[model samples]
Target chain A: DVKVTQSSRYLVKRTGEKVFLECVQDMDHENMFWYRQDPGLGLRLIYFSYDVKMKEKGDIPEGYSVSREKKERFSLILESASTNQTSMYLCASSLTGEGHNEQFFGPGTRLTVL
Target chain B: LAKTTQPISMDSYEGQEVNITCSHNNIATNDYITWYQQFPSQGPRFIIQGYKTKVTNEVASLFIPADRKSSTLSLPRVSLSDTAVYYCLVGAWEDTPLVFGKGTRLSVIA
Candidate 1:
């Protein structure tokens, strides 16, 4: 079975602080993604990495950045956290684009900004 | 990303078959329809995926028409634990993100 693990399952940060969320997938999938889920708004993509050092902005990329220095690890960073940025962060990975491949997701990290 | 639309919520009793329909009018040629189940405070779990016709797994079945314009997720004899939000996505590109709809919140009653 494919397993995706996140470093922190829950985190709390003060306003204007820097936050880093780490994710690692055991399957060595080529694609990784970060998304923030909110009630009534659904899940909005923040950033995605197709390969090492290659990143792409998703629908909502403001105030969020991602790093993919290695294949198994993907990190989401908030340079300066704000209260409005608090959300449930999900990390997912999949094989290269082809046909219909289901994304394997991590447990998720609930971030609270005060 | 192809657009998808589904009901906001649904209510069903235990042991009943629950079918949720998702409409994707502009699904592309290479696009495939996929369904995910999400529980509160957890990430979405992959349920099923199909390009056309029908695909079935231990958990659920996916039915897609010839036109590839829509898809339906059928849950067989659902149990109380099956209650959760179901999201439908039309995406074949892995790097490309799947657009999630409001999703249908299914409540199972005894």
Candidate 2:
């Protein structure tokens, strides 16, 4: 079994405020990802890292950035949060050894920016 | 990642079998179809994955045809807990990242 934990469950922030959402995975998975979930937009990728100190922009990575300092931890940073940036942030980790099918996800942090 | 298309929502009763089909027009030979179930306020969980023919696990079964243009996920004896959004993903080997579709929202009524 894999356990993915997020730092926050609910967050509220005013406009132009900076926010940070953290995620940790107990399983030693090489691939980590960040995604934002909206009502009608579904889940859009923010960023992903295959290895430490490396990052790749996903479909929606304009307002968000990611940091992967260690193997088990992945963090999402919202620089100057806006109302539009308010959404459910999800972090996922996958075992890259040999071949893997699924990416385990965290509980998700719902961030609201007013 | 191959683009996938499934129904927006579905309605089913308890103890009934629900089959959600996904269409992938451009599925490659090496691509595999995977399914994920997601409840409200939670992330998606892996359900099943298959490349060709039938693949069954303890929770669900994945059926794929020979042409590979489409795939079906079968859930038998559904309960109220089965109500969730099910996503269909077709991942290509050469594709770096996996793409998840909008998914089909399943409603299990009593």
> Alpha carbon lDDT of residue B58, candidate 2?
97
CA lDDT, every prediction?
Answer: 0.90, 0.89
lDDT of 1 by residue, A28-100 (tens): 7888999999889888889989899999999889999999999999999999999999999999988874663
TM for every model, in the order presented, reads 0.95, 0.96
Best by lDDT: 1
Q: Highest TM-score, which number?
A: 2
TM-score (chain B only), all candidates: 0.96, 0.95
Q: How do the residues B1-110 of candidate 1 rate in per-residue lDDT, one tens digit apiece?
A: 78899999999999999999999999989788889999887889888888899999999999999999999999999999999999999876652667776789999999
* Candidate 2 lDDT for residue B19: 97
Query: What clash pairs does model 2 have?
Result: none
Docking tier of model 1: it is: medium
What residue pairs clash in candidate 1, if any at all? none
lDDT of 2 at A27: 84
Give, for candidate 1 chain B, the lowest lDDT window spanning 10 residues: B92-101
Q: What does the lDDT read for residue A89 in candidate 1?
A: 95
